[model samples]
Target: MPAALRITLTTQEHQTLKELEVAECVPRRTKQRATALRLNAKGGKVKAIADYLGWAQSTVRQTIHRWNHHGLAGLWEAKGRGRKPSWTSQDWEALEQWLQEPRSISSRQLSQRWAKQRQVFVGAEQVRRILKKKWRWKRFRKKPPVPKNPELKAAKKRDLQTLKLWAQEDLITLLYLDESGCCSESPLYYGYSPIGQQKSISQRSRKGRRVNIMGVWEQDNRFEYTLKVGTYNANSYLRFMEWQAQKAMKRLFETGKPTVIIHSGRFNPSCQGS
Candidate 1:
């Protein structure tokens, strides 16, 4: 079937293996590996070496190959080679069940629970690694809030997909509208100016009033924004909507394309001046 594995050892190599095979404090596994190599060097057959050492023929062949490739280093166990994982299939099944509980569990808490039930001490880091590498679990910043109406939410999501398709096909332009305010006292912390000049911000008053900004952004990067001296009110918002309507009508008249505007549905009391 295949050629028999063989090895030839130098005088110095044989002496070193012999000493390692009989060293009082050497681990038994290392001694076995050393003896297997020594026997192969002395013309012992794989099957005969395995029978003598009570190891499998495959193990003996592996020993000969390893010694040929790695010399003496292969006589010791390789890094990350040792006992099989203590967590069995049943243990993983139990872990899966634990994860399905309504209440969430932290990795450290789960490790403690695992130690109590299985009588084995696995650290939180190890538990996290297994969850990520083996189970493909991910870390999320926070859980999303449960919607009050899930069916409506699903319908809205489907509608959004349809809208995106329409926008991609140029059937309609999609725009997003948002509003926020900032105070002059909190100027941008950083800005670029000439090499010798420090950028300066000038305010009309020592304590400047808030500047309200309303902006509408099109999916294709076109946008319009307005800055108001005071907070936005219902009348101001209505005026902005009217301006957008006029712009959309002009675009439709010229390009024959319709437009759809989307905004966060949350109502702001300030928007109504209430």
Candidate 2:
């Protein structure tokens, strides 16, 4: 068996102990537990009190030491731990304002500006975090426009509305017909470029010419017909429409009457100089 030791608390210290035990705040609970163990028969050894209270001996000893040194206020949470913050709250506010300005500044440029204005040197990652958390900034990429022409915008909107109406009415005979040209010898541009050398150079295959492709889509199904004619004008477009109309008539004759929607490039009467 180990030697037994007795511990006793002064009247004033005992009163302080009781006050902590009944205190409503959470911080007081830790202090109370420490005090209670110290006043017990184990003789207030740092390790003994810490073991009884299920805390680190250092922590138990520190609490008593702090209480003795600085009184109750020292038991409160500290302002911060480790090294002090290099940037003040005011510095963060200024950084946020600078970011909000309409200036195309890169991360490096922004970091330099922050270091100059706030007198605090920070890395790109730290700046990014502060911007995101405080200013709600995020990384974003630009998207290309789907339709560049104003007239095409109106036309596409009209086409979509027409298709939606046809679908809602259960019109199975509706079709979307249009034509596009593809150059067989056209070279492909795989990547994107912001600026600099190589401008106005056409990337097209040397041997092949552009081929016009007339296509139609209906209810998620598509049909395409290609024209091998040398030069295409208004006459060729009408002729293509006529051929499609004849095919539609033949199909209707075999089956029943079906709603046929015909769409084409704008028609010009003077294409053949008629």
Candidate closest to the true structure, highest lDDT: 1
Runs off by more than 4 Å, candidate 2: 1-60, 63-90, 101-110, 116-118, 124-163, 166-217, 223-274
Residue 229 in candidate 1, Cα distance off native in Å: 2.6
TM-score of 2: 0.32
Cα lDDT of model 1 by residue, 1-274, tens digit = 5588888888998898899887756778889998888888788888899999999988888877878788788778877878678788888778767765534366788789888997657898978766753343333222233434888878988988998899999899898888877786644333222233343333222245688888899865788988898767788888988999999999999989998987854424355352
Model 1 pairs in collision = 234-271
Q: Clash totals for all models, in order?
A: 1, 2
In candidate 2, the residue pairs with backbone N, CA or C atoms under 3 Å apart (3 or more residues apart, or in different chains) clash, namely 185-205, 187-204
Error of 2 at 206 (Å): 28
Best by TM-score: 1
Cα RMSD for candidates in order: 17.4, 15.2
Q: Give the per-residue lDDT of model 2 (tens digit) for 130-170.
A: 45432433332323323258898799789778867765676
